[model samples]
Target: MAKRKIRGTEEAWETGELGRDEKYVEVADINESTIDEALELQMISIRLQKSLIEDFKLIAKINGIGYQTLMRQILKRFADSETKRLLRECVRAEEQEAKEQRQMEEIEESRKRA
Candidate 1:
């Protein structure tokens, strides 16, 4: 067996062999809920066009990730961007409204002085 050095570590291990401190655990007893909880994931289902799914699968294969994971990442990015955009719009609207209110107050004060 060939020895391989782990990246960013001072440890070396033999390729194609388990370390003395490592052992494989039996996975037969593990269930979906256990995995979801460990990964902090929630299960969801949605229907999409077959063509879209196929496209995602091809892209994900090229990127070395599952299609579902790619879709989740895409959704997260869109949500974050959309939330920021909406927040900016809200701030602009609030600022305009405050400016209009100040203008109205100034007009009323001028009318009272006249």
Candidate 2:
């Protein structure tokens, strides 16, 4: 793709615009990628009353983020944190205790089938 110089009209620097500079810029081809992950079960059901929906939109607009994108990022971050915490706890569990006992029992049961 070819690159071209673009002048910034005053409207480009409007309030709540993200990463806006006062000077004109030369824009190149935009490179963006979408995440591809297996679909998981939906976990949340949200009910937004009229006033609450309005307030949520207001907050999102002020922060210069799309409401849906903001929510997706927030949930992804929280889930990542929770998964890390659970993994850490699992790694710290006692090998000579309940975990070892459970593993031994499973092996014994498998041997009986053979």
Candidate 3:
């Protein structure tokens, strides 16, 4: 492995290859009317108990939002949380497997030496 000197160039930055400064941008004036519509959605019909729907509606009313919107938020939050947890577990399992593999390799090398 050899260390190499890297050349720095200002052409990439000075030529406006990067976007213009948006530090003074106003978000409230932005036309995002169709932003919600732009998001992909799938429609699926499901059967739910009346009590559940009533509970969801009550919660939604308290939150000042529609029940369906509240449901979507809850589902998205649960899914995102579970995804992060699963990813962490997967990484831990992979690290443990790699550690075991390295230990086995060391043991095999010692056996060969014997």
Candidate 4:
């Protein structure tokens, strides 16, 4: 069996000071005034499964966004997909109706010639 590498000591893990790397620059006080407020947000409360919420938080953290923002993005994508699907179905239905109408007109013309 391969030996697994142990993580940092308890003290380092607890203090969360693992000697900051030079590559990681700490940022503070970003001015978001330039950002456009295109959408008016409303606050609402809802219940979600604990595990699902945890997964959302983990994914949001990975993407460097808040969980609520991630959820909104996900919802928007789903809504757009559903809207496209409905539009395609409507177009197909209209095409089918036009095809049937053409077929009926051909049958009527043949009857008139007979």
- Give the true-structure RMSD of model 1: 5.7
Model 2 C-alpha RMSD vs. true structure (Å) is 11.4
Candidate 3 structure, TM-score to reference: 0.64
- For model 3, state the Cα shift of residue 43 in Å: 1.9
lDDT of 1 by residue, 35-106 (tens): 899988998989999999999999999999999999999999999999999999999999999999999999
Model 3 residue pairs with clashes: none
**Can you give the TM-score per candidate against the true fold?**
0.69, 0.39, 0.64, 0.63
Q: Taking the tens digit of each residue's C-alpha lDDT, what string does model 4 give over 1-114?
A: 997654678876567555455667777554454233335455579899999999999999999999989998998899999999999999999999999999999999999999
- Measured over all alpha carbons after superposition, the RMSD of each candidate to the real structure, in angstroms, is 5.7, 11.4, 14.7, 11.9
Candidate closest to the true structure, highest lDDT: 1
Q: Of 2 and 4, which scores higher on TM-score?
A: 4
Measured on C-alpha atoms, candidate 3 has an lDDT of 0.84
Expressed as tens digits, the lDDT of each residue in 1-114 for candidate 2 is 896655465555465253455464576564332222234434467876888667667878999988766677777899999999998887778554787899999999999999
lDDT of each: 0.88, 0.70, 0.84, 0.84
Q: Per-residue CA lDDT of candidate 3, range 16-100, in tens?
A: 5444458755567544545555665566699999999999999999999999999999999999999999999999999999999
Q: Looking at candidate 3, what is the lDDT of residue 13?
A: 57
**Stronger candidate by TM-score (1 vs 3):** 1
Weakest lDDT window of 10 consecutive positions for candidate 4: 30-39
Show where candidate 4 strays beyond 4 Å.
1-38
